[model samples]
Target: MIERFYLKEFLTFKEADLEFHPGLVVFTGPSGSGKSILMRSILASVGLDSVEAQICESSVTWMIDEERYGLQNESLNTFRHVKKEKTRYFINNQSTSKSSMESISSTYLRHLSLKDYSDFDPSAILKIIDERISARSPQYAGILENHRVKFAEFKILSDQLRSIEEKEKHLSELKEFALYEIGKIDAIKPTVGEDEELNLIKKQLSKKEKIETVIAQAQGIFSFESHVSSALGMLEVDSAFFDDAMNELHSIIESSLERMEELEEVSVESVLDRIEQISELKRRYGSVEEALEYRKQKALELESYETMEHSKSDLIKQISAIKAILETSAKELSLKRHAILGETLEKLNGYLGMLYLREATLNLEPCELNASGEDKAVLGLAGTKLDKLSSGEFNRLRLALLALGVESMNGGGGVLMLDEIDANLSGEESMSVAKVLRHLSSRYQIFVISHQPQLTSMGQQHFLIYKDDESRVRELDDAERIDEIARIISGDSVSEEARGFARDLFERARGL
Candidate 1:
């Protein structure tokens, strides 16, 4: 339960702090005296408004005792700060996010008001009834979980099949494109390493003449050495002294003559063969590496097209199987849900007093199955639907649903906050609303914002919101509450009769 709320610079409430107790806590005030402003401030602090206005500076603290509900070692305080654009929420002094705070608080604070009649929502109604019925059957959650997974899988497969079916007409065109590409590369008959071999052969042919010229120059030097031999013979006249030198000179000339003859016999056939090989490579492939890459691409395309039909058939089969499974699961779920609808209607009718002429029913009509079940709620009163009910009747019906929910709750109930729930209600209807709210307070921490005396008197903790002379809104207590309630009864004039009426109402509420 929310233990205390503080507001600062929020609308007319410059600064105010109020404490709340268990049971019914009602906020009553004159018109335009910041009653609604206070309520909005509280909602804003909890991150429920879209005003984009900063908190100015405020703190709200909720003291939770989970042990009362059989939870272990879980006593903590939750708080919210409205200082900057982003509201900071904290639990047990640890920084947290608004969503986290709201989630945790919701379990402890179940706010039901006349504005939100649970019976009107089929999902919430189903959940409550299912919980009661499933309490004896622990396998219900597992069953629901399994069905949910199956439904999701079926949806995914069906969507994929639809996509493939839509594109099937173009599959033939795609196959034709792939075949054309593969055939174009296959006809080339390219080979790897052909480019490098061609490059080597081309270099040899281009430098062929230069290599031959160098060989010829070496031959001429050896062939013209006859003049040197003649000069060596003349130098042999110094017979005995020149004998060793002349012999060495003759041996060198003979060896040079033999090497010249061998050089002159060099062949051009190897160069001619290399030139022909390079020319052939250029004519066939343009470039050997490019042709090899083309061959690889063609092979991949052929493989892809060959397997496409098989893949399409497999996807179709999978989609059909998933659809069958989903249909079976959904049928089982619908059967179970329909079986329990009758008991749910009985409980709703029992709580909402038959005098209201209301008949709530659930219709499991055929609908396109989705994540939620294919069922709808239709609430009628005397053959008139709930949407057509008068505002007063709607409020009463909502109150009845709340009373029923509280009674059905397993442990102490959630905190219930109501804003102007008593509006447009008749005196007798107001009395009935008060009685129900009073009974609900025993199970839930009920916070009500009402203008009716019946509700105001029902409050276990009465707080009056009013403006001081400075026009700043503040919460009043003790004598201030009595004076404010008296003012509510007397309007601008607080006569003895009005004071007496306010006092009598207070006394009777205390006794109750």
Candidate 2:
């Protein structure tokens, strides 16, 4: 619940601080006295509206999950928004992102003015019906869950079957391509590292003459080895060490000459052709190893194409089986929904009857399987689409749904901000709406703007928005409330008769 709201430089409100209480809080004034501006500023403070204001702040006292908002345990929290050249949002004085502020504020605040469409959503309608069923019949709830799961599986299989059928039209062409690619790779039989081996051989063959010259020079050194041994044998200082050194040098020279001889047999053209073979495969498939992997994949694809007729038949069978299951489950779920539709509509009419509105109609019909279900629900008011209803009628119908659905809620209800919900309503109808709202206030914290004296009398906390040179807002004292309601009853001038009626209305509301 919002405990306080403050606005600065926001339209007609230069600076205003309004304290609020739970239950129905109403703001009443003449038409041009900034009632809507105050509501917009409060919405902006909670990240629900974009308003040009220097500052908009709200102090809320509700049991919130501190961890979810990344805060320590606290009973009261302040949300502040300031708009300069760019708007900045803050929670507990710590700057945060706009989305984060929206996410947290949405849990506690709901602004349902003229344009909210959530009440008319088909999926939302189905969810409300399911919540009712779940509360009364847990077994039916499990059945609905099962049906939803099976329908999801059916959608997946149906999509896969459609894709495979599209591919099946070109099966023969796909088979031929896969086989051609596999055969092309197999023809080369390319091996990893074969390119490097061939390059090494090609390098040796390219420098064959230089290698031969080096081997000849090394052979000359071996000739000097025998002369060195003879001199060392005569000196007798270390003839064994000198002979060992000369033998090792001669061994290395002989190995070089042998290698040079081997190069004579190597054909540079053959080595170049082998390297080109592997390089061509690399150009097509990134690397030799990748080419081999591609060949393996295409081989499997070719095998699948060979037996595609049987696979296609199996897929058709699977789709038919899933479709049959989906249809049966969808019908059962539809029946259960329709079973509750009459009760829901009857209860809705009770609320609408009090509000002096026409009854709403529920239409459940078949649709192709979707993520939501195979049933499409359409809610109509007085034989007309919900979107075509008048704003007053639409808002009252939404309130009716809220009345029926609040019991199914899992957590504390959110704050409801209604902009002149009693506009265009008759005196009795306005009182009925006030009565329903006051009842709903047990679950939701309601803030409403009202032009009707009956609705204003129902407020637990009332504020009068008035304009002198500039617009301002102040909590109405008991005597002030009577004057305000009397003004609302009899226009700009308050008459003695209107005051008497206003007093009686306040007295009656207080008794209720």
TM-score result, candidate 2 = 0.81
Instruction: Estimate, for each residue in 1-512, the C-alpha lDDT of model 1 and write its tens digit.
Output: 66777666665666776767778888887788877777766665554533333442223334444444222222435355555755565444556566655555666564444344555676665566556555656676666677678778777777766766665677677667767766655554445665465455556555656765665565565554556566667875434444555566557655655545544564446545644554564565576665556557766766765775676788778867866766776676677777876876687676566324366655656677665455554555556677777766776777666676665566667577777877876655565677788988888888788888777877888877767653254445556666666787778788989888877877787798
TM-score of each: 0.60, 0.81
Cα lDDT tens digits for candidate 2, 396-507: 8888888777756666587999998988889998998998898788778999999999999999899988898889999988899999899988987889999999999998
lDDT of each: 0.64, 0.84
Candidate 1 off by > 4 Å? 50-125, 177-336, 354-357, 370-374, 381-417, 438-446, 471-487, 490-512
Return the top candidate by TM-score: 2
RMSD to the hidden true structure, all candidates: 11.7, 4.2
Worst 10 residues of 2 by lDDT: 64-73
